[model samples]
Target: MEDVIVPIVLFSVLPVCIWLVSYFNYRKRLTAHETVRHAIDAGQTVSPELIEKMSLLVDPIRADLRRGVLFIAFGAAFAVLGMMVNFEDGDALMPMLGVASFPVFLGLAYLGLWAFGHGNKSA
Candidate 1:
């Protein structure tokens, strides 16, 4: 009963929180754009720095690297946990490795893309 309730509440609440966050972020961006537009329409001079900051994008390489590191860490943790469980209970080793390998592979792929595409080879 506790297990069922926990998962149900967790899954439900997580999605609702995520949706609220996403909605708020979108609203914030829209508000910013409206403010900038309104300022310009009102004959106000926008600073170059503000324009630059607003136009800046999240660095893809950095994002990929972050995800890769996080995935690798999670994979390693799961793999280690799987190994410990296997040693203790003599079951779930393959399942654990299987779960771990998914993230490990995904992380490796992200890192590979970052190295080959985003990072400078000559540097």
Candidate 2:
């Protein structure tokens, strides 16, 4: 019972945490946009700097590179954890590698996007 429940809870929590993060970020962006919209409707002068500050935007290439590196680090951490858990004649590493592959591939995809976008930017 303990093993069954633990795995179920662990797997379930990941999606919930991801959803919560996404929801909060969406709400924050929505609030920022609404504030700008309200200010515009009130006949106030909206400056480009104000919009940029309110949006808290980062460069796309930089953001992608940062995310890619972060995800790769996460994958590496998981792989390390698996290595630490493995004992002589144990097959623990392969399962952990399977789990780590998701983040590794995702990081690679982000890196690819960054490279593609970086090449298209104007000097």
Candidate 3:
């Protein structure tokens, strides 16, 4: 009963929290952009420097590498913790391994993306 309740709460809460945070952040940025646009429309002096910073380019390689490393770390932690846990009748190690496989596989996929000429994209 406890196990089912915990995962259910976590799955629901985590996503909703993330969604709310992202939604608010998006709204905040949108508002800031709107303010700058309004200022410009009213013949107010807006900072071109701020606009330049807002239009910054993202480097995909750095992002992918960061994600790959983070995912791999999470996967390793899950696997290690899974191993250290004692389950009833030793019947659930497989389940733990299954859980661990998700991030490990995802991390490997991201690393593969990094390897596939992402470094050359900016050149």
- How far off is residue 123 in model 3, in Å? 10
lDDT values for all models: 0.81, 0.84, 0.76
- How much is the lDDT of residue 63 in candidate 3? 57
> Which residue segments of model 1 deviate by more than 4 Å?
6-57, 119-123
- Which is the leading candidate under TM-score? 2
Task: Tell me each candidate's RMSD, in Å, in order.
Answer: 5.1, 3.2, 4.6
Of the pair 1 and 2, which is ahead by lDDT?
2
Ranking by TM-score: 2, 3, 1
Q: Which has the greatest lDDT?
A: 2
Ten contiguous residues with the weakest lDDT in model 1: 54-63
Q: List the candidates ranked by lDDT, beginning with the highest.
A: 2, 1, 3
Better of 1 and 3 by lDDT: 1
Candidate 2: list runs displaced more than 4 Å: 55-63, 87-89, 119-123
Q: Encode model 1's per-residue lDDT on 1-123: one tens digit a residue.
A: 998999999789969977996797678678778878999999999999887566443345655788798889989999999999998889779999998999899899988877776756332
C-alpha positional error of residue 74 in candidate 3 after TM-score superposition, expressed in Å:
0.7
